[model samples]
Target: MRALIIDDSRAIRMILGKTLRGIGFEVFEAGNGCEALERLQEIGRADLALVDWNMPEMNGYDFVCSVRSKAEHADMRVMMVTTEAEITQMIKALEAGANEYIIKPFSKEAVVEKIQILGLIP
Candidate 1:
């Protein structure tokens, strides 16, 4: 499986990358939404995207909307991984086409369980 992690924080990206790799995913990293879009264009496709809500250039909501607008990425799974912990934010993310939402400070087990629940992992 493949995963794209988009975050402005290098540390968060590194942590998520390591965790996803440990769970048998080939991971790609991007500093922000624009970089993530470029990376996706270059790589062709990703099975999943772990997007951060607050970022430079573009934000996670816009990114999700952009990806959702594309037919080629119709099946791409987007999971919002951020510090935004509000019902409104979560609703917006889901409405914008995110498949899941994981707040910051999440545990590796939590992430794995989410992937499993999404049936991205067997």
Candidate 2:
């Protein structure tokens, strides 16, 4: 499987890369929503994306909205992997078409669990 990891932190991206690869996923990364969009445009779609909530230039919610607006990208799995755990924020993410939400500071095991729950892994 393939995944696109979007976050402002290169360290987070590296961590996700290591974890995802261990789970048998080939991972790509973008530092923010704008970069994610560019990656999507240049190299085709990924099976899933782990998007960060707070980012410079276009944030996660807007990114999800953009993805949903494109019929071709309608089925891409989008998970909000963020620090914001507020119920209202969760609702907004879902409303914007996120397939799942994962709070930050979670373990690698937790990340894997959520990915499995989203059917990104077996």
| Leading candidate by TM-score | 1
The clash numbers for all candidates, in the given order, read: 0, 0
lDDT of 2 at 36: 98
* Residues 16-104, model 1: lDDT tens digits: 99999999999999988999999999999999999999999999889999999999988888999999999999998999899999998
CA lDDT, candidate 2, residue 107:
89
Model 2 gets an lDDT of 0.91
lDDT of each: 0.94, 0.91
Backbone clash pairs for candidate 1 read: none
Candidate 2 runs further than 4 Å off? none
lDDT, residue 16, candidate 1: 92
Backbone clash tally (model 2):
0
Every model's Cα RMSD, please?
A: 0.6, 0.8
Q: Kindly report which residue stretches of model 1 are placed more than 4 angstroms away from their true locations once superposed.
A: none
Weakest lDDT window of 10 consecutive positions for candidate 1? 113-122
